[model samples]
Target chain A: MNSDHHVILRVVSKALIPVIALFGFYVQFHGDFGPGGGFQAGVIMAVAIILYSLIFGIAAAMRAITPGFVRGLAALGFLLFAGVGVWALIQGGDYLDYDALLGEEPGGHHGQHLGIMLVELGVLFAVSGSLVSIFYAFAGRVSEIRDEDW
Target chain B: MLEFILERGNYWAIIGLMMIGLYIAFAATNLIKRLVGLGLFQTSIILFYISLSRIDGGTAPILYGADLESGHGDSEGVEAVAEAGHGVADAAHSGAGELVNIYSNPLPHVLMLTAIVVGVATLAVGLAIVVRIREAYGTVESDEVQEMDLSVALAEAVDEVGETQAASGAGAI
Candidate 1:
């Protein structure tokens, strides 16, 4: 459907999408060491996908990553966080106790760091999946409503 | 009042933004405008809180390599563990020479980040509701919606009145 689009828009998106995704990954992994965190990173990732959808059409976007998969990812993200907390509890530590996982580590902060990073990954999945799914819902509904209704 | 305004100009501007946003959100008829206004209102509140957290020349709440307590000595609303690495804490703990204090609060920024996420989620729900309303009502205008309800109510009332009148007329005949 987007076959007739301007060459510049496609070219720019092709170059920019990878860069945006890379930045998002950086934010996700190196958040605590730097300024940004999972939330910003998730939004950035969602924006990259959305830009792709806008340029390549919803059908193509859906083919790449289906809405059902996005919804599952959102649920999985929440579950991942909850599972981590439960694991801490099972290990005879307080809920969300990162120290319990790597108590043997020297200086102790490394364990905390690892726990935070894992939790941030959960946050990234939840935010990005929800965002993309929301976009999909809106895009799908557009055809259901007529122009005159507005 | 003049002194308050002059001394707290940033506060006054923040208040102005809040008032404008509230007016637009509550008084405007267009749904999209209301959404925009709500966004503005949220932004103003975030700005207000962020401004509250700032100190004249304070640094970030971290000390790069120095291990300090997670709490600051005297700064309120700021868990500035590493602000300037130790002068203020040393002064407070040792009760030695007085030093100039400069550390901005980091708590408000932390809180506002969560607030921003919640705000976006709320806006998404609101827009979804607006879309559904438009689908069912064919318009999103507040007045139009009210007018439609009023007309429906009037018609229902008329129907009840006519039914009662017809029953009484038949009984008299």
Candidate 2:
């Protein structure tokens, strides 16, 4: 690869990742408001990382977003979400009843909002992790074989 | 009415988009086309769920209290109680005009958000597999690969049978 092209690719990857991540957060938070939310944001964020991998090669991208850490984060996020639902159930409420979690608020909507936020955080973690994993799996493969048996 | 258009129209549009995407996925023989179909299908479903959350005349569900008037407008409480038919006519009547028309339902939006994430992840994995397929086969056309693989399997089967017959005849001798 040309040095100039390599530099440009690196720069583009570095530049776009933060902007994409910021947008993902905005989508996740503003989801209650409009046409975006946690899943979309997570995917978009992952796509940015994938793009970086595609441009700069898998090693660089992997270095930037470590696989083991992401896997743990994703698992933790899922557990947190499941924990909330279980907590609600344990409180003598219907499985995921947000009101039970809130424990008798003025209105039940507050609990629903809180539950959703927590779930969204979980979703974000899982998405970001899965996406990075996909990139790593593909990018990790050696494209060319030097050993010749034929 | 504005409410009908926003609520119903969005649903129909999303369904239509989903069907078109699904059709492409089912019919397309090209890997990229299938991926495109998958993308379309995923995106349309996301749109569908997002649309479900919108309430006519309802603002974002923010608790700012600044635009509370423009939000649900406290009209729904009365209508809901009246609709429950607890014999509370006055409560229903008072809040009737101020009620927001089911502008938002956050649950579906949340689910769809997850759906969107899953969809993109699936697409990424699919595309990666397609890349590997293209690398190995020098083509990403499904029909072509299937035909080739089928032919190769048939040939191997025939060769195996021939060898088995030759061995049997030799044994008999």
Against the hidden reference, what TM-scores do the models get?
Answer: 0.83, 0.68
TM-score of candidate 2 against the unseen true structure: 0.68
True contacts kept of each: 0.06, 0.33
For residues A73-134, could you state the per-residue lDDT of candidate 2 as single tens digits?
77887787788899889877887788787785323366788988888888777767776776
lDDT of 1 by residue, B115-150 (tens): 998799889899999998888788989889889999
- Best prediction by TM-score: 1
Residues A22-130, candidate 1: write the lDDT tens digits.
9999988878866788889989999999999998888889999899999998898888888888877887788999867665332235667778888888989999999
- Distance from true location, Cα of B5 in model 2, Å: 16
Q: Which stretches of candidate 2 lie over 4 Å from their true place?
A: A6-16, A33-35, A51-56, A105-110, A144-150, B1-28, B38-115, B128-138
Number of clashes in every candidate structure?
0, 10
Model 2 Cα lDDT, one tens digit per residue, B1-90:
998787577678789999999999999999999999989988887786677677667755444443456445444564466466754557
What RMSD does model 2 have?
Answer: 6.7
State the displacement of the C-alpha of residue A141, model 1, in Å, after optimal TM-score superposition.
Answer: 1.6
